[model samples]
Target: MSSISSRDRRHLTNGVKEHLRELSVQLALLNHRVSAGAGLKQVDLDCLDLITRHGPIGPSALARRAGLHPATMTGILDRLQKGGWIVRERDPEAADRRAVTLRAVKERMGEIYRLFGGMNAAMDELCEEYTPEELEVIAGFLRRTTDAGQEVTADLV
Candidate 1:
């Protein structure tokens, strides 16, 4: 049998890297299609969580809360607006022009939640095998990953 050189090994490794990169992109696109069909993209879900926690907020504030750049937030808002999952209204308290605020279209929220077959129900299914403490630990790890570069890595596709 012939032996392989170091260069050959490097080419093999590069091939694996390229394969994995393509797989990751395909999976990400599949996830987006699934989530959007379910009435939410990942960003839309994040924005909903922010609105649920903070009540009404401006797009700039939502950008900060979502840990996304303003341009990224604009795209998310566009999808959300198209879905009727969110809306923008002028802030009554602000006399100036730049006071428009973003908020959940509350009436559509329940339908959105229902479209996902009730998020809690789905999460419960996923967590069923884990103890509460174990689930908490997993959640903590996921949060940390997200707080770092996981969010950006996810959007790379």
Candidate 2:
């Protein structure tokens, strides 16, 4: 394989960073619109997304992942529960009898998914432009970027 020159590598890296920043802002705006459409606060929707992605998760774990305080998480959880977007149930497998886990309410997910349908469709169309190998590389970069963000968030917390 041919190696990129240092100058070219730096240029590519700067371009990627600039694109990522722009992507972040655009994603935030999209999420804000989605949250408004769903009648949920941005943080609450974000927490629900975390639970949907990582459930059945404990409240404490979800709080950590969302970078929210436990008390704040409790309020978010309560709202989600009241809205029928999520449920808290005793973790039968947990050794601690009272330990509860958060789960996204499957039946209620349709509303959220519908709100995101446009974005999902756009993303699918975007993915159609890339070959599988290129998509894999892009996915790998995104996964690594997400991990790095989590690590940095943990440090900040």
Candidate 3:
């Protein structure tokens, strides 16, 4: 590889910074489009994703994992149920009779998956050019960035 001068390095870093900001905005807009295209709210899609990833989980645990208030989660679950996007069942081992667990309607996920799957497939192909070591660094950077955002969000309105 050719050596990059300090001046060139600064320019590349600035480009990456600007591109990352643009990516963030683009992702927000994409989520809005996907949500609308799927006839769902962004938060509802987020809840469904969480359930799809880690569901058959109790609502209280799901609410905590999602950073949503219990009351708000209740409404989200109600919508998901009415949309036929989720399944709710009694938590067999819970002492509380009202305890329930939820899961996404596995067969109903196709539209949401179809809407957002292209970018992930493209990103996976792009990652093929990187060596394992470089990818690890990229992954670490992303995790730290997510952590930083969570820290800031903890302080937000």
Candidate 4:
């Protein structure tokens, strides 16, 4: 095995742990604000995101995409439907069958998107302190981390 000093390993490992913890705290706060009183949780948001991006899909597919179990996705659809945030329509190709799809009620969701957009803008401004090359390096690192996570999780199935 290649040898690395304990100090060097600790430096790399501690930075990764610190970054993960900070990301978790930040995401929790963001979710709290976006999901407040919506009778929805983070999984619900993930379902919505999948539907929004991919258009109408069967509950099974939606569940798979959102990393949810099939039965739980059914419950999520019911809640979203009851809230009028999503609608289920008969699948044109399949008579007497419907697909669960989601669309944002623009009036209700626009404000949230705007708030999110504002936060992004602020973050971008903060990032301006770094040169474009520095930001590129950071982005590359993040992308590699994300790709690795996806690969490892995909292998578990």
Model 4: per-residue lDDT, tens digit, 53-129? 77677777787777778888889888777776677766767554544345555455555566467668888898989
> What's the true lDDT of residue 8 in model 1?
97
lDDT of 4 at 117: 76
> What TM-score would every model get versus the actual structure?
0.54, 0.92, 0.82, 0.73
The TM-score-based order of candidates, best leading, equals: 2, 3, 4, 1
Candidate with best TM-score: 2
State each model's CA lDDT, in order.
0.76, 0.94, 0.90, 0.74
Taking the tens digit of each residue's C-alpha lDDT, what string does model 2 give over 74-121? Answer: 999999999999999999999999999999999989999999999999
Q: Residues 1-157, candidate 3, lDDT per residue (tens digit)?
A: 6799999999998997898899999998999999999888899988988899998889999887789999999999999999999999998899998989998988899888888898789899999999999999999988987898888988884
Q: Which pairs of residues collide in model 4?
A: none
Task: Say which prediction, candidate 1 or candidate 2, comes out ahead on TM-score.
Answer: 2
Cα TM-score of candidate 4: 0.73
Q: Tell me the TM-score of model 3.
A: 0.82
**lDDT of candidate 4?**
0.74
Q: Which ten residues in a row have the lowest lDDT in candidate 4?
A: 95-104
Which is the better candidate, 1 or 4, if ranked by lDDT? 1
Q: Which window of ten consecutive residues has the lowest lDDT sum in model 1?
A: 111-120
